[model samples]
Target: MSRVLIVDDAAFMRMMIKDILEKNGFEVVGEASNGFKAVEIYKNEKPDVVTMDITMPDMDGIEAVKAIREFDSNAKIIMCSAMGQQTMVMDAIRAGAKDFIVKPFQAERVLEAIRKAIG
Candidate 1:
């Protein structure tokens, strides 16, 4: 099973992702509410994939992606974006995110992105 780290400002969003991932047989290694914590968790847990939220308080997903990529070039990050954040998504991709899923998330899409990212 792929180990996943979920990052979002909302606890509910993190809970939702955890539900979807665990149901799909993905192991949730860690979770973080902001980009700063996300980076710290990435280093500590070293999850195979990360589902990162775009607009966060400490640091945005794009900056977190860059930080993780810097720490581990092979880091696989999947941005979790809201509907209107197309530009931010693009920036995340450029920052080395492997893929992305939009919110409110579909379990299937989330699983697909994780599969593709791990591949």
Candidate 2:
């Protein structure tokens, strides 16, 4: 099972992501509510994939992706954000995210992104 880290400002959003990944047999090794903690957890836990929320109170996901990539070139990240932020999503991809998911997330889409990201 692939280990996953979920980063979202909303507790409910993180819970939803955990539920989806666990149901798909993915091991959720850690979670962070902000981008700063996301990178910390990424380094400490070394999760196989990360589902990162774009708009968080501290650090934001784009910069976090860059920071993590600077340390670990092969870090697998999947950006998760609300619709209508195509530019931000593209920016996340440029920052080394392997895939992107629009929020109000569907379980299947999340799984697909996870599968692709981890693979």
Candidate 3:
């Protein structure tokens, strides 16, 4: 089972992800509301995967991904992006996110990205 860190500004989104990951046999190790906390949690939890939101209040996911990658070159990340965020998604990938899932999430697609990211 993989330990995962979930970073989203929305409380509901975090809960949804935690529920989905838990039901799918992945551990939700930590949750963060913004990119700054995301990086802090990443360091503390050292989860196997991180599901990061692109448009966050502080720092944003792209910068957070880069910061995480700086500390851990092989850190596995899956970006959670809204529709029509192709440019940000691409930036996230370039910043070292392994894959991305578009919202509102489908269980299958989210799982696929998770599997692909950690596999």
- List, residue by residue over 71-116, the lDDT tens digit for candidate 1: 9999999999999999999999999998889999999999999999
Off by over 4 Å in 2: none
Where is model 1 poorest over a 10-residue stretch in terms of lDDT? 91-100
TM-score, every prediction: 0.98, 0.97, 0.98
Write model 3 residue lDDT over 3-95, tens digit each, in one string: 999999999999999999999999999999999999999999899999999999868999999999999999999999999999999999999
Q: Which segments of model 1 are wrong by more than 4 Å?
A: none
Candidate 2, backbone clash total: 0
Candidate 2 global CA lDDT score: 0.93
Worst 10 residues of 2 by lDDT: 110-119
Clashes of each: 0, 0, 0
